[model samples]
Target: MVSAWETWVRRLVTRRPGVPAPAVAEATDPAGTRLVGAPEPVSRLLVVRPDTVALLTAAGTDPQLRRPGDLLVPPLLSPGAPPVTARAVSTAAVDLDVTVTDLLTFDGHAVDRAVLGVLVQLDDRDWYAELLELAAGHADDLEEYLLAAVHRELTTAVRGAVRMNRLADLQRLTLAAVLQDRWLPARLGAGTLRCLRTRVQRVRWPGEDEPTVPVRPPPAPAAPEPPPQPTGPDQSVPAGST
Candidate 1:
């Protein structure tokens, strides 16, 4: 049966094939190495000495590292081995002390003897100090790029929100105006007629030469005449009545 340690090493190697086994050692070593932090996909490995910390790339090589600190230190495998240290004098070169520790610590992952065996086979090379300078500059550029991208996203969202709000407001105002117009009465001219008039009066037109004539009122009907007084009763009454 495969040991648990072997299985773990296999899994780690499979997950990140680009990461050399030695790099893993440097990452796991507690005394020799420490994980400063991982900013997303990039992991920063700090190689420490008695005095200062030397920053290494996530890939374990410092191509753009500063001068006098150009040497690459091999990973620690044995508990009894000496400790590893590095000194950077300029941007182009570096000096390092190599040591061994019984155990290493990295990002909470532990690597022991079996795992260290697979790591020591990897090689190390000196990286030019100018490479570190280039990397430093590139890091700044990346930050600016990311900041601009975030700004653009925020601006777009704000604009869309504003446009939607404006449309809703306009709709509300239009609805209000329509309701107001429907309920209000229309205005009328000064000479409009009413239905209850009992008379029709006519006035002469302006600038006419004819004298003004008064309109005549309809004549009152003559009072009904009273019947002729009855003839004296002495006279013989005629058969036909008047």
Candidate 2:
């Protein structure tokens, strides 16, 4: 019987209006476990027996799907399979939904339950019971697995926090630049300063403590000298000392 995951992939292929079905490749780790690869343009599906489903990414470089312990296992599974469940973990965009078909094709039927549980938790959906069951089944490695899971959680959280901080910093810088550009001092002079007329009332200067000296305009030019006072007819002003 075709696995539920496989069935989902077929449905996805039909639903997409113009996109063509992706090519499937078989990926084998040194240990010889086989996983189906859903290459770019095609979503990969992973089938965990009984009741787990996951979609693996098919874009850009394929993501490695393995648990911490997998490192100890010779020939780690590469491009292992879709996680039964996955969380956004960290994303630069809005929430993204992984289609059932995509999940089934990314990894085909060789995922560890513990890893799947981590995915489910990250997904933050209604798979708590399944997550518990997976955890219960792997009691031996429960502690270690949980630790790794928490590490992934913290890693994602830190990345998100950093991104948020950077965004806030950019916003603040933009506001400061805009304000400085719009409100910079227009002119400065000895004891007097001028700003845009709109901001005249709002301008503040450093030496407000010192009284402002009233600016006096130069005395108007002395009324043009009355044509030489007709002194000649009145009192003869001696050119030489009289």
Candidate 3:
């Protein structure tokens, strides 16, 4: 089980099986993901991890997305694991920690680039059917598929807002407002992965500052512990007192 996680984790850190490593941030190379719906026929038993949910499908049945830490094995003395038809995929954490870099956005007349990062988590129950279908492409692993699908979502959302608004509007932080206003009510889940937070990493044009969306702030840092009181009492005698 440990080995399984180790192997998967290492792959998650890189772009692909034998590609040169890219500048990975919180999540390996989410922006660098190239494949989504690739063949992942499961033969041996698989132990799922906390960071991801597993997608599986057998003959004559609908595809299912299994939760994290789930063990995929035949029930006691079955022939073997069932066939997985569609390309498999994995789910990220519950907390919003996913990020994507470098996206192209349109501002009515001109096209601009805004490096966007988002924090997201998997929607355990409902994300199964819809998400897998959206991530149809070519990828060896599930995480790559997930990242690619998410990238598409963020890209679409940003582009849509930028297109309607003007450069002046974005400078006034309207882009952030538009995303929240529209996506929030509809539940921005590109492929069922819910949007938790968003940050403007940077913008192509000069003098354009990143804007903050309305979201929960990071937890306050824990207070420092005070120096321990002298233990075992008067062994060291109070200063100038007896």
lDDT of each: 0.27, 0.26, 0.49
User: Against the true structure, what is each candidate's TM-score?
Assistant: 0.18, 0.17, 0.48
Top candidate by TM-score: 3
Better of 2 and 3 by TM-score: 3
Q: Write one digit per residue (lDDT tens) for candidate 3, span 41-123.
A: 45446555444555555665555666555666643336554555333243442222223334333544454465554555555
Order the candidate numbers by TM-score, best to worst.
Answer: 3, 1, 2
Ranking by lDDT: 3, 1, 2
Model 2 TM: 0.17
Candidate with top lDDT is: 3
Off by over 4 Å in 2: 1-128, 167-242
Tell me how candidate 2 scores on lDDT: 0.26
- Looking at model 3, residue 163 earns an lDDT score of 65
- Which 10-residue window in model 2 sums to the lowest lDDT? 87-96
TM match of model 3 to true structure: 0.48
